[model samples]
Target: MSRTIFCKKLQKDAEGIGFKPFPGELGERIYDNISQEAWQMWLEHQTMLINEKRLSLMDEDTQKYLADQMDKFLFGGDYDKADGYVPEGK
Candidate 1:
């Protein structure tokens, strides 16, 4: 499959998704109530993304593109959006 499709599938899976009576929202709450081990793994995987390793399995260019997209998705918009930070180069 294409890289974007593969990435999309991974994103959905990460959020505890698949065929079901409802969507993954309930799974998210279930995960919130899950054991420490599961939460630890989740944090590790999140770190991998932050470290730009989650896209390491893909080709180099695709990895860079995905990394940029992730950066924008997680860190874009107004500088004062969060409780802190006026953002860089403002």
Candidate 2:
């Protein structure tokens, strides 16, 4: 049986990730509160942020920025988006 969590991002009960998606306390927090669907959403958003902003994962500052954005995306009720991006079929 799949586990369910009170997903913070979705603000609803949903299927939870089976394992810690990251290392350390943040991973533990996500495992406890984030849903699989929400995580997938974040992944898509992260891709957009990377591509639109030309973020290099090798850069420490970029890593920090992504981390901060992830926190806001999941928990802080706000997040950054690619500047001037329009959704497909919009």
Candidate 3:
């Protein structure tokens, strides 16, 4: 059976991810608090950030920036958005 958590991002109880999505303390926090659906939303947003900003994963600064953005996206409730992006079907 799948585990459920009170997902911080979604603000409701939902199915939890199978494992830690990242390393260290943040990963543990996410594992305990974030749901799979919320995590998938973050993944899609992160991809948009990477593509829009032309970020390189190999760069240390880029990694830090992404981490900061991830924190805000997951918990801070003030996440950034891709510049000039317009949702489909307006």
The local lDDT score (0 to 100) that residue 51 gets in candidate 2 is 91
Q: For each candidate, what is the lDDT?
A: 0.36, 0.90, 0.91
* TM accuracy, model 2: 0.92
lDDT of 2: 0.90
lDDT of 3: 0.91
Q: After superposition, how far is residue 83 of candidate 2 from its true place, in Å?
A: 1.2
Report the C-alpha lDDT of model 1 over 1-90, residue by residue, as the tens digit: 111111221233233223221136533443333333333444444454545433444578854554444333323422112233343467
Q: Could you list the CA RMSD of all candidates, in the order they appear?
A: 15.1, 1.1, 1.3
Query: Which candidate, 1 or 2, has the higher lDDT?
Result: 2
Candidate 3, residues 1-90: lDDT per residue as tens digits? 799899999999999999999999999998999999999999989998999889999999999989988989988658789879875688
| Residue range 5-60, candidate 2, lDDT tens digits | 99999999999999898888888988999999999998989999999999999999
**Which of the two, 1 or 3, has more lDDT?**
3
Ranking by lDDT: 3, 2, 1
Model 3 quality (TM-score)? 0.92
| C-alpha lDDT (0 to 100) for residue 42 of candidate 3 | 92
The list of candidate 2 runs beyond 4 A from truth reads none
